[model samples]
Target: MANVVVLLLSSYTSRLATSVLLFISVAHTQNTVVFQPSFLTATGPKTAALLLGNTSDISLYLRTVSPSSETGSIGPPSCVAEVTQWVLTREQVGKSAVRVRLSLDKNLRLCGQNETDADCCPKPLCVLETLQVSACVGGTPQASLLIQATIHALLVPSTAGSDNKTVIPNQVYQTLGSCPCDLTFGACDVRCCCDKDCSTETLKLFASHCLLGPFGGQVSPAPDYQCSVQSAEDSSDWFPFLCVQSPPENNPYLGLFYQGKTIATKRGPSFQRPILSAPLPDNVYLQGSPIFTVNDRYFTIPQKVLGRCVTNAPVAFLKNFEVECVTLLHSCPAGAPLQTLPKDLTVKVKNGQGGDAEVDVIEEVATDLSRFISSTDAVASSDERLACENVTLALDYKFYWKGNSITRISVTRTVGTISLNVALTTRYSAVFLNGEFAGEPNSGNPGYQVGLPVIAGIVDMLENDTGSIQRTSINLWKPVGDGFCSTAEKKPVLFGENSTSGCLLPVSGQNLTQCDLLRETVTSLQAALITATYVAKSGNPDYLTMTDWVNISYVTLNSSTSMDNNTSSCYGIPSHQHIHVWSLITSTVDGIPQRDIRAVQVSYSPSTWALDCGGGDVSSCVDPMETQLFPITSSVTFTDIPINTGPPKTRFQINFTEYDCNRNDVCWPELAFPITKYYTGEPYSQSLAKGLILVFFFVTASILGTPWRQIRQAWSCAAL
Candidate 1:
């Protein structure tokens, strides 16, 4: 009978252990198996309460992360709130759970006194009324989780036989699933938590249309916990492209917190280049030369489209721009068609000069360049072919010279029928000498004529092509004939002249544009020159130019005269000027290096005077009668332009620091992509984080293959 009793006791103990193990395992699996809910979401502050179910009784716990004396509830939210971690107490702890009513004093839901401020959340000696508790004890963990459930008081008796003995096993949680979208913690409501508006269909459609996802917090549909979407401005402060900070708002109830990275799209500081570097289509000239309206009164080249991959070019390629004659004319004559200038015709250059050189530095340019440059009729033979008769030939040169001199300077232009030469001569000479290149004593010698070749090509094109001069860049090389040895930086002193006028465009349109207006063409050219000067004078590497464009503003003569360390053979003369000249070229969009264009030409005179000429003639100067120039030209094109895109937007990511329950440390796994709906038709269901953590732990335990039931039975028997 004694042996039988012992065996029966053993069997009973085993059954008891099995029951306990099964119950614990099932509860653990159902409660904390995965730290995440089936569907995870976010909400804004005002609607944060909606994330919770009205029928369910849920309690929240907070543990401060950052050091802040102010303690209060997360209410009256205007933006977003970031918290350290949170814990949850559900109404499911059996009889002990009944004692767990929210402590009004320590709940934090009601305001309390703060250390620095009177209006703060108050603390209590015994804030919690429940006997059974899962407490968070110590230092910060990588991750923590909050689990919730509905409890019924007096469901079961206490497990302790007597005075205050705790016996419940600690539950651990793992993460499972994550949401695809971002959720605002305080902006959600139960009514809209999983509503049609919050459905995946709507989000996907929005993403496709606006190229950005709506805020994550607009999921909850509960009245008090309803969520509202926050605008992009709410994510950060002014200058979103620069600094980032925490959202300025209170925390929302039952919402998510996340940090992460995502793909972004933005406009490049410069333009894009095509892979196939080519030139604009050759003009089909009616005779030997390009077709013109008034027999050289104006010249026009058929507008053409360039491709991508033609990297490293300037914007001056389209310096002399204009509309096709047919596009502007009321009608074309049958036999001898007359091309007319368009009232609103303008000029444009792709990669004016160094556009291609700086191509590699730009992050990304628009691939679909067709949007920037387009033409309706392109077929050459078809009647749809645009007659480029309204083309304008913007001039780029102005010559100046002194009076009463044999050496003359003038501007000569020759297009198809428009060919003329203008001579600029001085009427008087302040300083003059017979036929010698030397000027009079203290007077300035003026010349009969001075030649300016900067705008020579432009004038020629206009004279021969019947083109209009809507815009142009003319350089004036002030040949300071060596005589006045004044050591001073000489910037052009615009007395009675306009420095910003001429063929340059004004600064009014977008990226220097004005509804295809001829006036805009000139203003843009001027703007390009100013841009180039800014770059050269500032000495910023980001603004270095590789190609000289149409508007070659001025060659900065940077001279340095510093004392040298060696003074051995230096007799007494002061310092010598070490001068270097950098040609400043400007395009509509400055700083570009190379580009596709009809033609490119440059003419400049070589240095005429040597510093140490013959025998110590230190005061010698350059002869005003001598001047030379060399000209060169290159043609280019662009082939394939890519497509257009928008800005960048990213979603939040949740990371699991670790799995811990002691001292109520919540281990929340970072949420993955968001889900559309989260209604489980039950209260106390695991959240996305809690569910995932619990699931991980459950799987781990299963993999361990330990006989938990047998272990529990043996332990129970021993205790008995």
Candidate 2:
């Protein structure tokens, strides 16, 4: 899961000015998902209710629960009360479900206690925070979930158990299933929970088009909604990539530890090889070119889609941010109150576009953020929605306490002036038990026995196809592929060779050779993975001269003999397994020449699922391993590039030719080549004569009842 996410992110992010900020909003129940018409207008202080239903067969106990302040709310919401008289009482012991009513505390005010204060409050926008809850099965720590919650006075309090509905955002809805389409066929009713846009026509269109149509099967390109994200003044801020948090001074991957790795570039500062590796205390090798941000320019403003209600409403962007101060309160403690960092954070927001202030980092704002309020009316109408723009970034700081040393630096990103990077900073509480920064684990095993070949193939995606500039990783698994780094070992095929691990895709062995990941082509995948890296490695400043595409066969096992269905391993599994991959990078800027980047075409027959159970029957196949990439071939190109001034405006396009993997998409396949159940360290015979000898030996062993132990010994002796 982690590796896939990282690869998908890193692969598609080359054209981005910076890396994307990955904010994982974990969902609890069907109720905790993203829903449509997500934004709700709040006129004033109001009550919001949440009803949690546990479908587990056993009694479930609700323990600690609350809304984390990461939502950027003006005040803390007490789960106990909706009004003066009523409190959240249903959250008692041993109940399958419970209803909790939340309301602003009597003393809790959106604006400061003092009305004249400049930091009273910023213009209000409907913020979707999380409803964090801890549940226990029979009081034995079951699990915790973060349910999505929107705080607004005008929101219709969702009745719990509302047909087990969720507020999945439009994207999430499409990902989960076709909304109105599924709803029409009764396959699902996800749209019923959407911000109630269901008209008679919408329903009819959904049914006729989705279910009852001749062109129905599932929409090709999923539908998009008026979804929006918070806007930052600069694209870099919103899509955090770089970092003030210096790379590991001892890590060799970033060339930081390579004391003499400084390579002089044609223009600008000296550069070094940006590859992932550990430091070598003895010596170092360096010199690789990469694209760095010559300059930065702000892009689209961040926003939260408010449906068609405020479709044409004015969108605001942050002009600049100010951090009055950053305080070191106390040592970390479990469940202690969160004393907000960056003593006073404020944003100077403006309507429409904002000017570039050569934005980097600022210490203090003119006034406190609480005082950064817009002139929008105190009352919000259904159509008149507020675009509460907040640009959150990261900043590094160190504090000394009474002559003592502070080695590990604690990080913060919410509010205040701070340096931002792609790393996941602290979100909500530090306690993992409360489901803080919670996420779904990527651990699934299918029955098709896809084996390790597909796993290796997937891991190949994490190769060091680094662009000149690299984004810091924030996903749960940052050092992507760390999970598989040493998960398995590859035995040496030749007698004198040593076994190697972590080389699943390349399938490390004496046979593994320098078949360059980039096969010198005009369009190749590895280059697209790191366009900047490709630019540097290409050695051509103006033109990427690896002209013309190359036709390369699917990477094979590097074996002398090709074992097919005609032959099988001792375990009755096919010795030779094939995985098809074709990744190409090609692009043309309208005004610029098209002599940059490279491409490689890979062709191979789609493999079949190595079913372990039944005789590979489609129905009997439990967990199917995909034998081919849906798009057996894929390409990415950057177009309409503005090279001169202004930020590089690149149109990134991916030509994906989909194919059937093992039939359905339910099963995910990994690389299992170069890996066999048994290790013989003996190469196969290429000639028919040698092949016959090998076949005769196997047949003789089987007929004479020769054990595996004796067979291995005989093979070893023959090698000797």
lDDT of each: 0.24, 0.27
Predicted candidate 1 versus true structure: per-residue lDDT over 223-279, tens digit per residue: 222122212212322232343333324323222322222225455544563244564
Q: Write the per-residue lDDT of candidate 2 for residues 563-595, one digit (tens) a residue.
A: 343111111112122212222223222112232
Worst 10 residues of 1 by lDDT: 1-10
> Using Cα atoms with residue i matched to residue i, what is each candidate's TM-score against the true structure?
0.15, 0.15
Query: What ranges in model 2 sit over 4 Å off?
Result: 1-359, 362-541, 544-605, 614-720
lDDT of 1: 0.24
Worst 10 residues of 2 by lDDT: 4-13
In candidate 1, residue 176 scores what lDDT? 21
